[model samples]
Target: MAKEMQKTSMFIERNPGDCENGDICKNLDDDGRVKRTGTWVTASAHIITAVIGSGVLSLAWAIAQLGWVAGPAVLMAFSFITYFTSTLLADCYRAPDPVHGKRNYTYMDVVRAYLGGRKVQLCGLAQYVNLLGVTIGYTITASISMVAVKRSNCFHKHGHHVKCQTSNNPFMVIFACIQIVLSQIPNFHNLSWLSIIAAIMSFAYSSIGLGLSIAKVAGGEHARTTLTGVTVGVDVSGSEKIWRTFQAIGDIAFAYAYSTVLVEIQDTIKSSPPENKSMKRATTLGVSTTTIFYVLCGLVGYAAFGNEAPGNFLTGFGFYEPFWLIDFANICIAIHLIGAYQVFAQPLFGFI
Candidate 1:
């Protein structure tokens, strides 16, 4: 064993980039893999892209069901839980010694490193399943946004009374084709540009929604709202109210569900300043930003439409006179989901 150790030390001295396990050394990082150039900014962009998605579109409806008290409360609660857990998961990017230990390229790798055995397999299954569901959800949401854009244009041309119906199948096919091309991207490190663009798109649509809600409130066209949310008897039956409340809570929780990819995002950050530290900061910034947007969109949308808020303010035609702006927002949603689909799908691709 001493002789083996001596030989290993000699080899390491001669080839500093080489590892005992014969991992790749060319263009390698300290961990004998491709060098990481991601900073907290890019990681934050990735987090934003992943976290603030179609889920944000449903916040107004969620708030309507949850009411004034439980709506914002649930949103804040989920945001805190997501940020707290993400910071912990970020530290798991590297095992043994977080700063200098072996890097776990994917979440499952982290699972294997620290919680080896059947648990690794179980975690991997769960991770992939979750990722798959997210991608599917993004696909459907993107298609809906596309359909909304077309439907908005039709409404503008034909008048509000017209049906203006549009099919989602073609839009879904188009989204799938786009993904096929984007999937060709080599890996996560190469996705900073896409994430940045998607992050911007998320902001664009969210801002538009907020602006529209504010306009409605300013115009004094606010819908009926209560402190507790939709009325138990008038808006919905007691049992129905209970079910809707739970669904709203689920929607709020889903809005903050980016922990599945937290470690992968951390893996992309530079080693300097310590990845865990950088990731924690990124998590805070990303989640805080998302929470602020969620608060504005959810609360303002609820204030504007109250119990009558559509499932999606933009796509649901909550604002009709500014047809062009609504079209732009829906288009932005489609663009954002296009990139988000890849963010959530990449891990599954890598795992396979």
Candidate 2:
């Protein structure tokens, strides 16, 4: 009889609350308290995905132009900048949530709190432009991945050099649309889990590719091959001038793209619990792990590709003919890029 009554009460509670000139449970918990339900790993994964993007593929090409020395230097400089910006933003968010009893504070709220009035309006306008740019970049990278897959299949409809145009390929658009729709279907919590898995996959891809690239170099294969290229409108005086320009900016651009997420991660960490030494230790460990992974990736890509290396570092850096891993990495990166777009676009979208 008690079990039957308990089951009936559970069913009643599942439905919408009914009030007949009466009050309700404000906490919405049987014990009358709210609970926090996420860990550092989940937060770290979210931040990492926010940091990484389609930029990972292009980093190698950028590094080749600038030489190895500039690569790490740029990464460290950008890391400091990102960390500062993220911490500032996170501090801005903390107060509003407590004052208004709000669950989350959007970017617009911060602008309104600090700038007020017309400044908020101007900020919103800028966000619209930024969001558009991010979405376009995400779509373009996904299409590129799809085209890469198709070309790899000997359906040699065209050479590997063909550019992927969304207009010409309806199927590619459909595939991308499917991914976007699926992405939307997953709630934020589920999407965060997916982000964690993708982060792990990214770290693994970097480690394995770097390891293989190093092994090959140690065995006497210089791996001097060009997997891809891009043409710019700027006219150079000579191939030497072009090479110099590449040497100056190539690695910096790549490093900048990958390190953009450091700021986001810092923002997340600021909000987390630091009850004991473990929190500080975890933060240090997470940052160190990511840094080492980045260095390994850059080292392997540099050794394997040499100067003629492809613009996308992972291509020839890994063992040849591991088609499954290649496809998996490509897809993982494409998905990761979408999350990067999400973080970038979300703030901008709020302004809109």
For residues 300-337, what per-residue lDDT tens digits would candidate 1 score against the true structure?
99999989788888888888868889989999999999
Off by over 4 Å in 1: 1-14, 17-26
Pairs that collide, model 1:
67-229
| CA error at residue 222 for candidate 2, angstroms | 3.1
Q: What is the lDDT of candidate 2?
A: 0.51
Error of 1 at 57 (Å): 2.0
Give the per-residue lDDT digits (tens) of candidate 2, residues 276-295.
Answer: 12223433444456556665
On the 0 to 100 scale, the lDDT of residue 36 in model 1 is: 75
Give the lowest summed-lDDT range of ten residues in model 2.
27-36
Q: What's the residue-level lDDT of 169 in candidate 1?
A: 98
List per-prediction Cα lDDT, in the order shown: 0.88, 0.51
TM-score, each model?
0.93, 0.66
